[model samples]
Target: MVFKDKGRVMDGFYVTGHPSVPVYVLKSGVIFDGGFTALARHYERDIRDILGNTSPEYIFITHSHFDHVGSISYFKSVWPDIKVFGSVNAKKILSRNGAIELIQRLNNISRAHLLSYGVNDLYEGEFEPFLPDEVVEDGSVIRVKDGLEIHSRYTPGHTRDFMSYWIPEKRILIASEAAGCDDGSGYIISEFLVDYDEYINGIKRFMEMDVEVLCVGHRYVITGDDVRSYLLSSLQHAKDFVEMVINILNEENGDIDKTVNRVKAYEWDPRPFPKQPEMAYLLNTQARVKLIASKYMKN
Candidate 1:
């Protein structure tokens, strides 16, 4: 399921993918990817050439993670006149907080990212991180073209400000990392959980929608009425997760890490969960804890 052409349907609806990079272009010339890289030794020209080479009128970011946003600078350079859109929180993070610490941490472990791009992949030259030019919050509608409307819906279980896109006209929903990834197998791999219930609710929102196409961040996309049915099934899995975590916390007196692994065992595919067990636990624990914490905090 490699996305080779400029525009092609994965399940249904136009999309494109990069070999090491993740690039998706819509039928309306809306090009979207998460990041930009300047290292040509790796592949592709500087961020400048990648954006300049394409005719994408608009750019939408799924989240502000390093991989997802590596080519943002390229788009901004070529389409200085075009608008770059991302979650409002992502915009604020780029503008207000300098994520230097986070970048360094990611680089330390991102050997694969470097190897994929090829050669001295670490930021060596006068490299600068790509920042969003504009912000689009939850429920914001992106008019890709006439009759093609992509709606930005907030689903913060992955990251606090993460969002997924929906197109009502086509009944297609891009879940980003919200609904998690279903390998050809029976289990699901989650990106990270900032809020388990909200993530489940987000999945439910899309499942309830009149969607026929469901494109996620990675892996194969699912379509037809079966999309909603699968989503509902995923939601049940998540709910069972919440219940399992609750039971574990009660037994171990809030052992977050222990509870996280207990849940991870339920995953069908584990490669996407990352190697370091602690890192995996850290990513998944916060999501469940936050979901429970919010329940108590609500008035």
Candidate 2:
């Protein structure tokens, strides 16, 4: 079952903001991702209502992408004591001025896109870049409470800093982009921005886990038998996407630019609204194509 509603989907899990860039919150006062600034502000009341009196104490960042961390500053302003956690590489990325600027720019573009879609309650502000308070390496376990523990897995590929959190007690895995995204189109989008091999390995690792609830990065919260089904399909999709890219690269005689354009025209241009921004899409596509061309086309 796919959940896209903006409320409590299960006992302790809540989804807020736009489904395209939804934020996940636990009743125990932990937020999975920051989401967009405007959307976060618009859904602030809903988030607070779900949290009740328990002020959010921690935010676990999946990666350092613009949309994934768009509302960190807003959350910090609301809960000044909230500590943010991410991988060590994420800390390095967020500290760079160029990265922050690009994030802000992409956020501005995203807000405008939202407005065009008739979303009028977006928060007005530039994206703020804040470093994580703690860096979690692979296999680090955070005790959320006496009985609840959030285990961090360093699953890179969507980004080198990507991390997936799993709660064994609840049988929930916050896979983020590590397990691909639904995008409301019933199609899983493989997001291997940095390394395709690592992305596939990350998916394989998730497949080995016993998951009941799977929280993707965007637009879908899968549950029950679908969890294993989704992970298996996601793994296949990631491999198929790479194969398609390699075929296109070969067709283009290993020309990265041409392959990127062809892939964009075939895969991205047909996607409807509530999708990734064109600039972001192009950048990620270029990275994927370049990686494939260099890694697979090396005679």
Which is the leading candidate under lDDT? 2
Candidate 2, 1-299: lDDT as tens digits: 87777777789888877667888888888888888776768557767888776678889999999989999889898889999999999999999999999999999999999999999878888887799999999999998854788899999988999999998988889999999887566667888888888898988898889888888888888888888888888888777888999898888888888988998887888888878999999998898888877788887
- Residue 191 in model 1: lDDT: 46
How much lDDT does each candidate structure score?
0.59, 0.86
The TM-score of predicted model 1 comes to 0.73
Model 1 C-alpha lDDT per residue in residues 196-274, reported as the tens digit of each score? 6677778878866887767666555666756766677677766665666677666756666665566566542354422
TM-score of each: 0.73, 0.97
Off by over 4 Å in 2: none
> Which stretches of model 1 miss by more than 4 angstroms?
1-7, 10-14, 18-21, 35-54, 78-80, 96-100, 113-127, 190-192, 261-281, 289-299
Best by TM-score: 2
- Count clashes in each candidate, considering only residues at least 3 apart in sequence or on different chains: 13, 1
* Model 2 clashing residue pairs (backbone): 38-123
lDDT of 2 at 8: 79
